[model samples]
Target: MAVLTERPAAPVRRRDRGARTLVNRFLGYAVLVFFALVFLYPFVIQLGNSLKTQEGAAANPLSPFPDPLTFAGFERIFAGTNFPLWLGNSLLVTVLVTLGRVFFDSLAGYALARLRFRGRAGLFAAVIAVMAVPGVVLLIPKFLVLNQLGIYNSYAGLIVPLIADAAGVFIMKQFFESIPVSVEEAARIDGASVFRTFWSVVLPMARPALITLTILSFQGSWNEFPHSLVSVQDPHLFTLPRGLADLVSGSLGKGTQYPLKLGAALLATIPVAVLFMIFQRYFVRGANEGADKG
Candidate 1:
């Protein structure tokens, strides 16, 4: 009874602001869902049509549900093609290349980041320059160099050129620079040699960067076609990508076998997809750290 009147009802502005925010959030979600559908649409179609008969796939190219599913395409992929051999080769090359990239790139990156040497700045600048060059332009030069080295049509050609990537080196270098120098100094104080310090002390802290590099190396080497095309002419040495390309482009005689090709493509994509899913956290962390360091 002291005031006998309720404070004037709350101002309308607060409710108005909240309504605007709600409207904005709804529009944002609408846009995100629309784009998600657009991007996922093709993968859905591929997966669905891969299960369909050739006739069914051709008739319903855009459909995401097959009327009747068949495994004939998958059966043909293993039985009618050199998929197993390609898989083996892809596994070998990807493993070797990933190992080499992670080791050599990290070594070079650490050198550039921590080691004092003449022309260190120049060397890093050269790495940056190499990154700027288009890969297509280097193909011819790479071919000539490989031919001269007498390893052109061998695994050496396939693995060696790819083992050291400027981008990987840059990524490792950036990450190494972000680590506090005091950590390495402490290792040094504790009687650790440079290599031991790097291998034991610093490398453990670089798991995020290493995982990022591994994913990149695996994906790049797995999907590599142009390098394999030029590096090895032997059908026995073909990787999954090269084999898949040959399969799609008139290798399977006569009319378009969309089901078989799509099936093979789908299988080829699964490994990388699985790897990404497994290490997505490390990849995101590496990217964020890289951004902050930059």
Candidate 2:
């Protein structure tokens, strides 16, 4: 008699469980949608206002539609400013910095990950420790070193210091260690030099990690501002971020020129946007591999 009653209760319990799961899933989606809107709303407003006239933007600051669309702000950005020169300088610095970081960081990472040096463990620990130090604390020390090295206020000062990053070295080392050791040993047995093996055999296999490193280096160098502010005082050497900062800081005179400011900012973000869009697949793969390796 008890078994016959319990069978009926089993169906009721499953129905209740299914209802609870459905409610939880609905709540989860609602939370996700809410947060997405919170983050996306500002970008929508920025785009909308960039096309608006100055008077329209000022009067209806929160409005998402331009009262009367105008391209004068963009016109001024190209015609009335040093934005082109800044863009050129930014491109030059970003390219060099990205290349240097990819090469130097990968070499150091490979050495740390594979080479049997006397103090390899200690050196890697030191690299990890350096990453822990706040970037702000290094500004004064870095400035003093650049001054001493006679590279202050030059392109060399800006480019050289940013070439190698401890976090980047750490990322490369982690990914390199995750690779199969047998592959490297086969190259060694075939009489390949360590550099030759690393350059030819190992590097090609590290495409995901290399792509990850390249994007990071490009983004870091492209959006860099504080380093530029401290390293070079000359307007001619200013990168896009530095120039954008100058534009925002009362450079265009009184009143909020929202259209011009937003337009400039939008232009500054395009390269990074394009880069992420093109390489998003590799980035996702690298992230998954990193998680597995971790």
Candidate 3:
């Protein structure tokens, strides 16, 4: 009698569970949307303020839209300053760094994750240890190294050290470890070389992780100021952040060139902004991947 009654109870329990799931999903989305706006509002203000004139921008720093749109700021960026040159430099550095991180970091990561060489564990441990080293503390050491290599004031110094990061390697290694071994095993059984298998088989499956690292590399190199500060003293070598810092620190003359400064920042931010907008799903996937791997 109890068994027969319990059969009907299954449907009732499932219906209640489905209702609870629906409510949870709705609440989750609501929280996400709210926080997204909160985090993103500053960029929105930057975009709007950049379009305002010098007076307008200074007067209304908090406004979301320019009262009267002015191209004066952008005009100054192009006409009065070597904005295009800095933009080009930033793009060049970002591309090379991102590519290097994606390739080298993944190779190191996969080796650390899968290969069973002597001292592999020690090497992986070293990479994690390196990641814990604070960036600011490395400032003096990096400068000394760059000077010793005679690449201190060159583009190479700015781009090379940033190419392969410890964090990227660690992230990739974690993701690689979480992946099923059967996939790599199948490729190996077909007589593929390790590099060939990794290049063709494993990396394809690591698309989410790769994109995440690429995006991080791009953002990091793009906003990099301290490295640029120590790497080169030449105005010609100034990336956007370096140039912007110069502008803010009275190099752009006495009063605030608010509009021009904001305009430059706006342009500088667009690439990462567009990337974040389009690859948002991958970002979420990457976050979840790290959580699972850890």
Candidate 4:
């Protein structure tokens, strides 16, 4: 019989390395928790102050609770201004814009990624250049375009321009590139057209990427203020940001009503915050998608 000698010493190196890794992971989590609180505490303060009265808020700006909690702020928000209307308009615009972007962006992205069409490179280059243009600088230029198109001061002006974004297209294109070409080839072998393949097979596989794009579009259009400011002028046509700006700028007329202001801001934040909480994982993936594409 061959003598089976025990391996003298399975090197204990792996065991030592794993212990070090566990310790490092623990420390990393501790650091992350610390920073999370640092960033999140202000929102906590805002929520608390929003419940206080004007005097209470002014007296204790940093307090997270009011001595005598009041709904005066909320009542005022409902009664004193057109808060409900603004909220409704914001919702309508955001939903339409998000849906439009998800469709248009993915369509364009698929074409760029899979179609060997004329001017494909040039079109993508133009998209990159468009994305480089600063949004603030486009205020006057966008206004001019809207006026020229006869959509200014209308809902069309507000919602149409936001439907297609270069960055969103680029994001989708990069994601499509990360997928293997064999999948598309297989679909083609089955005699499926490009759109049919993309809609049936590819898009379902791209659920994670789609969710990320959806969340980004929702947050971006919901929080957009400058675009709304320049797009429409009529109070009745105003989105939440436009109405909110009008509310703060002498429209409310007398005192500095911090509670009411904070209340409106807090309410404005809730939808996106809820969406962020629910789709937190998708958001994380989306943020990292760019790195993966690179």
Which candidate number maximizes lDDT? 2
Off by over 4 Å in 1: 1-10, 253-255, 284-294
Among residues 3 or more apart in sequence or in different chains, the pairs in candidate 4 whose N, CA or C atoms overlap within 3 Å are: none
Clashes of each: 0, 0, 0, 0
What's each prediction's TM-score? 0.89, 0.89, 0.82, 0.85
Q: Which candidate do you rate higher for lDDT, 2 or 3?
A: 2
Residue pairs with backbone overlap in model 2: none
lDDT of 1 by residue, 52-149 (tens): 99889988799888888899989998999999899999999999999999999999999999999999999999988887787887778888999999
Off by over 4 Å in 3: 1-41, 285-294
Per-residue C-alpha lDDT of model 2 across residues 206-285, encoded as one tens digit per residue: 98889998988898899998899889988899999999898888478656788988988999998998988999886676
Cα deviation of 183, candidate 4, in Å: 3.0
Can you write out model 3's per-residue Cα lDDT over 91-125, one digit (the tens) per residue? 99999999999999999999999998999988988
The stretch of ten residues in a row with the least summed lDDT in candidate 4 is 1-10
Query: What's every prediction's RMSD, in angstroms?
Result: 4.6, 3.9, 5.0, 5.2
- Candidate-wise lDDT, in order: 0.88, 0.89, 0.88, 0.88
Residue 219 lDDT, candidate 3, scale 0-100? 80
